[model samples]
Target chain A: MTAAATAEPTRRDFLYIATAAVGSVGAAAALSPLVSQMNPDASTIAAGAPVDVDLGSIQPGQIIQVFWRSKPIFIFNRTPKDIKLAQDADWQSLRDPQPDSARVKQGHEQWLVVIGICTHLGCIPLPHQGGFDGWFCPCHGSQYDSSGRIRQGPAPLNLQLPPYEFLSASRIRIGENSQA
Target chain B: MSGYSTYKPQSPFMQWLERRLPIASLIHSSFIAYPTPRNLNYWWTFGGILTFMLGVQIVTGVVLAMHYTPQVDFAFDSVESIMRDVNYGWLLRYIHANGASFFFLAVYIHIARGMYYGSYKEPREVLWILGVILYLLMVVTGFMGYVLPWGQMSFWAATVITNLFSALPGIGDPIVTWLWGGYAVGNPTLNRFYSLHYLLPFIIAGVVVLHIWALHVVGQNNPTGVEPKTEKDTVAFTPYATVKDAFFIGLFCILFAYFIFYIPNYLQHSDNYIPANPGQTPTHIVPEWYYLPFYAILRAIPNKLAGVIALGLAIISLAFLPWLDTSRVRSANYRPAYRVFLLVFFAAVIGLGYLGSQEPTGGYVIAARILTLYYFGFLYVILPLLGLFETTKPLPNSISESVLREGSPAGASAPASGA
Candidate 1:
């Protein structure tokens, strides 16, 4: 193809190149309206802004679901044994290999918070259902360890960790990516 | 291209403008005075009708978009308001909705016309491939548009179809998440689909310009499938082709208006009236009528991945058609064996579409499997085999012979030289 083109340009060849170039440029210029739309709008971003959850009322060993930006967020108040189990589980053979230590915030491991939605196909994973006792996606049979690492089935990643921080002994803030 | 120039400016200012941009000359050469085969039928007019339909869809779609919200909470209500509250919004919304159905209606006929006439053969391969590209765009745009109303069928259809991508091994989950921009098909997915749904029609329009440009470059293929041979074989596109296209456009508009006015929901699913609830899935989840035939092919296979592959191949096969049927003859009119297969192929498609709409069951599944076999068999097996083995009728000496044989002179035929 290169050799054929290297030979002097036929009129048709010129027309093809010129029209393709012109069409491509026109397409690029026309795409701004759509490309600009994907950027998070003020209202949508504002909806996902930092939300504070009252951890004071929640008892140990219990998990509750909260909504931020229309996504379900799971806040788990882990007991001492729950924290030890999550940290001590073998991390060598995970579908998404991340250690328990890496998942939770340093010195705040007792308050385990993760996005409630399953990574397999985005269905909400039911808590305390799998062999690992983390979560189980009924939609696609994905199992997550207590650390939220995918343990089995078709899911390729662990439950996503939302940007969150401990606000106090009894409250936590989500959707803010910063050291509090 | 055929060398026919319809422009000759007498006024000095017009001549100066012509020399600068030659817009008048381009239009004159491409449309007004272009040479078309004299024996062309109403089937040939569908290309013009499709062009008109595209414009109508874009105009109506743009107006509908102004009042339509993209959020999941408000999308269903917004559509209801468009139907109930907005001034003449019902007319515009119905026209846009039914216009999509009519657009596909015209396109299918247009495609069948090309297939029957062998318009995809040599020198026209690029033209046909561009059409396939246009078709894919239409499918994507149409799918996204269906999801925008945020109805029961729309949500589940989006769920089912999006999950089809997860049939891919390993990479599937990440791709789905990336597509959704989150764990589920929530705000991000809807926003992106809305943006793309709005964007693709203009892209279709752009490709259409290319389709027409290529048409002008190579010229139209007639029912005879023979290239024009001399001046007597063809007529100028101006009054002759224009008049035919106009008449057909009028007839097509009548059909389009009837559906919009009397039966706007005829093509829509009854389930779509209910607002989208992600938790509840309709028992009989089906795609639109235009997509049914392919949907049937998808469900015929029990395996999920294979079903997706089969569904994809049904469309991909069309792109390779120009090379698939290796016959020197272009028109099926001359190939009696080919003609029989084409009719059966058309029926098989319609049958598959019907099976698709009904719930897949014992008989339906078995029938879909058989029809699916025949559908692929026609393109992959029968078409190629017939091309090699079948005996075609003797060709007319020229396009003029074919045209003159049809009747007397249809009009003032500005015959062009050479096939």
Candidate 2:
């Protein structure tokens, strides 16, 4: 074959090989972090591990702050009265009715969970149960209900909930939830 | 005899090439035939300067993007890798990062130049309006691009700005949801922002084309505000304007290079050095300096919706400038009153920027609100009313007269005779 005719096939082969290499590299690069995040190991977890928290100390109508993987997670134990107050109040008109869903383990009721970061400007939401009976982000006046739902103010969404799972009756692991 | 002697035989290829290319005609039209007003001063060169800066930004940005990671998990680490690992990545990263600030600097100067010379007047109104739109797009693109790094400031800035949409009426919740692409500002939001951030620069480039096209249609306004009368009153754009623009551009590049080399991180927020932690909020969440003035306006008003409206008006007000100034004279040179007002306007903007950088204290907030009110009043009230009442000094018939008057000693020489 002449150089031109032979060159065409060689060029096609080179392009095909180059594209496949790049495609594989891209896929690997993309999946690596996600896979690691998915299956966090003992060493990785130990360095900046999810802490198991005993919610027995958390009183009804009160929230407990727990550190997990260097992030603050809010674990609120709401009583039936607190739930009734949230549902009956006019402040329930706020957006984000149920933002703490991801933080709550399956079949767990009256146990609310959320990332302490404010839904507005990421200020840690201060826990209070006054007339409104919810959390308030003092930085921008973002109000949240007993269920960690945004009630009012500048926050666009309810507070985030990091993945977590229940280890026992009183214990909860606050990162890399196995169920998720 | 004439045909045989005068017409020499030529190759068909050469003839065909000459006809198709017409290099001489192309050069003639682009450089020589296309007229620019002779009186164009340093101010007129800013448009060209802005064009050059835009080109630099795109070039540097493309190179930096090659190494940048858009994922929240790796974005900060990737930026560090670029600085430490990649060859000359520090240079690329610094240039792209600081290039954003320099771009805004040049654009501000360009806009100010337009204002001073009344480049926004009459036939140039559409051009000016297009410039305003381009400016708005630049702001949005910058905001989105800043968030891709997923640093402290980037994360907080995204959170602060995204939350503003929640202040909207009934559909605010849906709007915010659509904006975030999820319940919270998380991985999905970051991914979409990365995609859009990569896309907006090209859109800015497209708008800039329209900007220049509109500019070329009206031709550039000169310092004297007097239109060119004849070929003598104008110079060819090639050696004259092109060389002058090149000189200024070189000087500007030197300053830019100085920043890239000497003080690369001077414009950057220090907190951005830290990786984003959603749980811990930075004590002070401030935007980039270019956005300070408008951010001040946003915080000035007590009401959320009103503050947003005022900030929007601050930009939209520029669009009405053509109609606002009713003065027959276009340039600020002849309008003493307007010059003072322009100075005041500049000072007010600086004041607002300063206030925006500080924590919104009671005193600062009150001052900002007052200044914000005055800022709008300057454009909406003073500009229009002054144009009606303020008497401007008589303008020279041509640019040459204006230049000669300023150059010579006061009342020292007679005016030049008509050519």
Candidate 3:
């Protein structure tokens, strides 16, 4: 066979291989996320274990940020008076009322548990206490009461309370509640 | 030296390749010699901008997928993890989230530019149709991406929108179930939506490539709508078109940066802050602003299936624009009545979008229906009839004539001997 004739198939073979390689890469890249979703990394779960929080260091009526599973969880100790104020009939008149029965672990009235996300837009609520004694979403003017319930805001629900359990009088572990 | 050289003879393999596969010729035709319209304006830069934005989204989205969780319980927390733990994760998340809004903004302008210049007319019909397809895919991609957060708004928005499929006749319920991967928007729904959301952008990238290929094939339509006939009437793509596109892209980038840095959450809904709660529903569920006009159309009709069909048709009508507009002249610049109609059409769309945001009440619903009717009427009735009856300005002999008439210094000193 002539040199030109012999070279032609090899070039075609190269092109075919290149095309297949690119096609496979694109397909693999596309499927990788879906496949990963089906099989989560074991280390991620281990890393996301319930975080141990030091509650004693947090003062009454003061909100403290604690990291749990890499997410910011706000831990505020509401004094009996602060709790009474939040439970006042005036506060109850607001859009979202604070739950009388605790949503978190029982007998932890002093410890207020809430995920830091603003009930309005997902921006982490900045702790502000000018007119309202609670979190404020800077994005659109959504306000929440001290109990993490929507007060005079666009947010339709209360801030989330991550599942948690008290390990001792001064320490709590968020993301693993014994009370189910 | 001869022994060291050890050169193989022009292998039968190499020579055969050169004879059978003309790769150089293919590259030249596809990339180098492809004739883009010489008179294309700065407006045409948006197509390139869109391609760039799509690339940005895909790159950021791929990185995000590496960290995102698809499960309902973990999805919201995973996003939080990405923000708090992943290095520069906050910036990546912000850019991708905000990049979506910017992409839509560019496309809206691109489509509007097409309308104003009648870029969708005649020979460019296939190009416009491809653009419509790309646009539809973009909306779907955006919708699916929104559901990935598993936030309250994300959950309810998915719930509300997927239920629209339920408005379809008898098969609607089943279709929705299949879409959700169950009876309601749950873990399976989030999983599949996340998968598809990540997948659709690449599909959009493919369609956008086709869109540009079609655009290159037809050559770009210009402001004057007059075709360039000769070398004197046209400019090369590199220095002329490239510079113009670069300038506009810089300006667009500034606008994009301003949004990303200053008012990042302006486009986002508030309720998405709370975790997804299927038991509780938000009082008001509004979609992203870009979808407002169609949402208004969806609410206008009393019948569910008919509303869905109308909403679909509102988008599909764009594909028929080339035939719908029977004007011999393409640009609105030369068409006086058409220019007026175009402005009215734009206002009607904005009005519909605004109405879509408000509660579907007594006056708003009526206004939405009226605007929606006008929106379709602008495309179907006014364009075709105007093309038939409206008197247009006298035609310029070439792009050079139009440019000179507009008093551009560049075209002032053209050869005096030219006809």
Candidate 4:
């Protein structure tokens, strides 16, 4: 219904425009603090710095949890059969298709390194539980296979892999890697 | 607003102020002398009530903030101190907390009034969209405010809601991380939220200025949904509209004070009194009552990303309402089919809200799903089809005619206090 068809520009229209322009300029001037507040504060950025883990003590078939970037990182020392199961699984049918070799470094197949939080809703998944048993998130019943792919669950992707690399035979640094 | 301004300032100070700023004249023209439809109802009073509530929230919030600490460790104790140690702090805290709920209650009624009258129809589309933007801003502000207590419910609500962003495709986790300023809802997140929560209300105020400016620009939509055709159909805003608004606001304060004094914690979760422990999640997690209908819509869908999108759309869909309902007729008063559907739609929303509060299971999930479907269907299906097929009743010739026909309380009788 062209109900209030006052589209024709008038002196009041110009007044509104001029005032709004001034207001917008003032808003832009005030926006720096609004934006800068969201940036990682010094303490938070410091907390996010690279964390080093000594995997020497992490025996095969053992899973150790380490904190890096304020997230739990799981360093799993997979057994030979676990690695085989992870690798030999049909990667083609994965909800989030990433092969087992891709999740770990070239010679680090037995050392499965991934973030401990579930891909579904960030609840920490229980290690070696649920069907196909890599990690099971009890929050919403999301299942992750040994390779960490979302095999048969509501999690859209596999558990996230932090930027990490093998610094030595039994050591790794998270939050910084050559590729990333 | 009364076809021409005869506003000539006789007072020396007003003349001096008018020449320098002209804001005095603008206010007078927009508020006092503005011609409101003679038949405007108590529903119209909500705009003034909302403005008053915003002022209440800001005043109480600023005072509360003087004592409140943003640190997660101190946040809970700081709120307790506000309740226990600070003088008049308990009253201030209670009023501010319940003020938010009352604000929502007012805004929801205001929106319902607009919908029933089709205030969003042509010429007011921009105004309606601005209102939606204001609603979005309020939702964000409310959510951030909810997290400031750092209580169990507050902390977990922050966790669940911020993680809702992570359902986005590739940038989801990154956005969530950025939002949190870390991997989880922590001190950094709390700090940012506190800052933004304080900031958004001012922005809402700014939008409210524009909302009123647009209302004054286009003029008010009355119950008859008919535009003012002549000077006889409208009256100056000063005595009639202002008094009615004041009367309603006074009545509303009784209810507001009731909640503030008698049952401040009724709207709050018992779980929120307990401090937040990331390790221990409460058995049943739900947002505040105002957010439940939306929370229900989100959970009704099984897929994570889709659920998030559905929830997003539940709010965003409102912006499209002006265009979606293609009826030339402006009000449901004349449209019989629309009137029934609107009733059902409101009930479904209430049902969805109730279902959202319960544990999502065999019965609740089924109910939520059905209600969620109806919620979407009301806007997406019912409104559009009703526009095409509904047989509308004949409109009264003008607003004055409708008011005269009914012997309305707000009628042609001259206001006692004239402008």
Candidate 5:
């Protein structure tokens, strides 16, 4: 047994290792399809295609919810006061700190587009409800500011921004973003 | 480990089969002729009760699944149709649903019995750990099973639970999306959860087999925490243990039947009857009552990532208990201080569970925090420290001594059943 332990690697050992390695690779390759099949399928991906929201009908201080990829998207047409209140609040002192300008398009600051799901848990927040005048999650007491930044609650981050770019001044396409 | 098996086949065919397979003799040695400590009380019956509950859940779940639809659009209506249309469907659905609660109830009692008797100590650690694995599987299986109806509580519970993965730093969001199988909890999510719900119970059954195997290897821990030193200390597992188990199982089944026949939906949340709507959440979203203690632990912490970790640790901590508890004494009956602490620990867990159902508000949050502290402190701090300092009461030299001290003839009658 000692001699066997001290001896150089034999052809049988190499064969065993080679067979085991190849078998593992084969097993992994077989499992890949089974595992990846659970991911977003072609139709689900197609269903999540960029939705075009026509912002022409929106009035100031109005927040209209639209479904994009089965998630509620809150399109808040921020009034001048709403935008000012969002900007004037000390961004650094907030729970999830981000400047209002960073959240919305610099020129399109009046139009705040955010995925309306609560950051703490994925419940759709009630718009214009909470002390922050943005959203309040009823499931847990997570609150968001008018700029969609988390103000005061258990939520750890700002309300997420969907990928969107301005098609024209009054039109935007969600799920597609372009450089400023 | 107990006594030598004297299994002799009675007939030619059985003898031949036994020579070839020996499965009958194996069962004879393990179950029929196995030497069980005569001192095992009603608490020991939970193992058999749990096995029965598992079978009950599986048979009922499989029948319910035959009629249940796993689509987002049809899942809720499918359950409704099962209640109204399918023959004996409501019975199967109620049995399967309530079976989950009673199953957890039995497991909790079983665990408490183990802790009280220090059954998780050295020789039985593997058995305890396997039980923990079964418990974790049961939790996941139960969660997914609740998601099958696609009700308000089910959908939101899935969303929030799957989002727990998002508490991880960099890969969190991707993992959450992977779990959902799409952008959000919808058709794909429901389908995968249904598939897994069906698959997990069988895995639990497998683990339970190992749990029993481990139990048989170590043998049952008795109230005295004393190992059987002589044949008189033990009784054959057949008529004695089986009869006791059957009696308790009958009583347990009566309770289970009462829940199913009379107040079937009493344990269930009324909000679950409402169809799952992604746009609106229930006024207060809570998980099944079995999960309340851990849920309370999760919400006790204010931070998201930390809370998720705390929740995971709450379950995982039980696996480490065999080592955390450094007491040489096996049973709480011998450990005076440990017994008091054990009862307090039970109360804290019950308190936290109550807090979990209430709204997470000012007074409730504070209460939950206090209980959560005691919950962890009892396991991590008190258990380890008490073992080293506290003096234990005098223990019986052997299992038979304890039984004799009680003036019970059960142990003496063991040898009367001569093979």
Candidate 6:
């Protein structure tokens, strides 16, 4: 073979490189819609609009569930004893650590709102059950404290906190972090 | 193409077609005159039975899909309509539902037969992997199909299973959302699952073609674990193996028919009859019976991620069994120690299955953990060690010898009237 034949990149090499690069880009571009289509659509996203909940009738130590974007939101009217119990628990040694103060709205500690779904496998936790004065997930035995902190079982995290803020002393808007 | 036969088409048209497409000759060679071990037992019949079950599932599934609505609102009512309104829809629905259970039953037995005979050894590694792939596909298809009715069990099962992905540290939540096609398992999830459920069976059928092709290439492993040596050691596939396969298939059909007619809902959980309620999860959520053992395995671990990883490895490990088992002898009959361990392994599996059905608490959790240890140990430890330490019995010289030997299993051997 001639030295020039092996020394330099041939025209065919340029063609091959260009073809492969273009082919890969085309394939990825084509695949984008297939993957993108699986995401939450426009309607599902819009369905998550803020829901104003009436906490007026809710009794202390009582829990009521309401839906926002098809998810169960548990609103608890915390009694003094429940708040004390939640505050007294050691927050540092927990599986997922957060103080009772952090979980509830500041100055509105009497009202506790959390997404009722278990962090382990999305099963709804039964209210007012388990050793903790909060909720117990029956599906995999995950127990949460009155503050909805993970206390026991296989759940990796505490009950998820939804985006919400108080509208008034007895009213709250869920699915919105602040006044709209 | 084991060189078992040379096809000579009798008719001119057949000869002409054979020359062009050669499908006629291929079928003749692969099925009609293919060589199979003469000493194959009743356990060997499950492969044919599984194939028939696959056909039954696809045909019934296709027909059922015609009337079944995929929307969340209509899905549950549509199924009810099928049961109450559509002509013979009840029969079709019952058969399709029960068919999945029966299909798993046959595949499990077929897999057990393979494991016992060391069919995954050496030349058949690819075949075994294909079988494992087929099994995985079947599992996904079955899980998706179960969700189609939009029952309470279906909804919760979908939720719990999809939540398994969230065990991943970083990208897990996103993947789970992508899988759901929304924030939760809703109409989009159901629609996609329906589409995939319809798409997967055809893919399984394609892989099955590869599986059988691989099987024909390397040939079958027999109960004796000895490769057939000559014409005396084997018989033609047609008439001999075909007849036996048909007989067992008929027996399997009888059991299937009984389920369809008498106790149709016996295999199905009653909770599924109730329409899906996302807000309220059932007190105790259990998966389908076929998945019980793995469910038990998953719950056996205390950590969420570990449990998910363990559940995944439990299935993926089956694909690597050919290498994991270091034994040269294929048949468990010769490996006495291996045989005992194998039976114990089966017991553990059955134990796990039972525990999977029960709540994962107290003694059941402890028992499931112990059995889970045995399940992994049998594959990773016992199988490798037994192959090295155990003194296996002397093997039969050939398939013919094993069958013809004195005190051999009666009726297992082909009749003296012979092929």
What is the TM-score of each candidate's chain B when compared with the real chain B?
Answer: 0.96, 0.91, 0.90, 0.96, 0.97, 0.97
- TM-score each candidate: 0.73, 0.73, 0.66, 0.80, 0.95, 0.96
lDDT of 1 by residue, A48-142 (tens): 67899998888888988888766678888888888888888877766577888888888888888888765543466778887887887654456
> lDDT tens string, model 6, A7-41?
68877778889999999999999999989999998
lDDT of 2 at B139: 89
- Top model number, DockQ: 6
lDDT of 2 by residue, A90-136 (tens): 54355644424333555676777778876554467778732357787
Give a tens-digit lDDT track for model 1, residues B1-419: 33688579889998999889888788888888898988787778889998998899899899999999999899999999999999999999889888888888888999888888899999999999999999999999999999999998888677767877887889876666667665457667887899999999999999999998888888899878899888788888888999889999999999999999999899999999999875444545678899999988876776657778899999989989999988889888888888888988989999999988876657888899999999899999998888889989998888878666656556633232111
> What residue pairs are clashing in model 6?
none
Top-down DockQ ranking: 6, 5, 4, 2, 1, 3
Share of reference contacts found in each model: 0.03, 0.13, 0.00, 0.32, 0.71, 0.75
Local lDDT at A125 for model 3:
69
* Higher-scoring candidate on DockQ, 3 or 6: 6
- lDDT tens digits, residues A89-162, model 5? 99999887789889999799999999989988788888888898788887667889899999877788899999
lDDT of 4: 0.85
What residue pairs are clashing in model 4?
none
* Candidates' RMSD to native: 9.0, 11.7, 13.6, 7.6, 3.4, 2.7
On DockQ, who's better, 3 or 4?
4
Candidate 3, DockQ score (0 to 1):
0.03
Q: Give the clashing residue pairs of candidate 2, or none.
A: none
lDDT of 3 by residue, A1-180 (tens): 253477456766778789999999999999877655443345545766777877877887788886664446888887787677566636456566556355445677777889876543344566754245777654334667667777654455678889888889888888887767
Flag regions of model 3 displaced more than 4 Å. A1-180, B1-35, B409-419
Instruction: Tell me the lDDT of model 4 at B193.
Output: 91
lDDT (10s digit) by residue, model 4, range A64-177: 888887677888999988899998988977878888988989977888889887776666677878788587765555778777778755567889898998899898999999
Q: Model 2 Cα displacement at A155 (Å)?
A: 8.3
The digit string of per-residue lDDT tens for model 4 on B42-158 reads 888899999999999999999999999999999999999999999999999999999999999999999888888889998999889988998899899999999999998888788
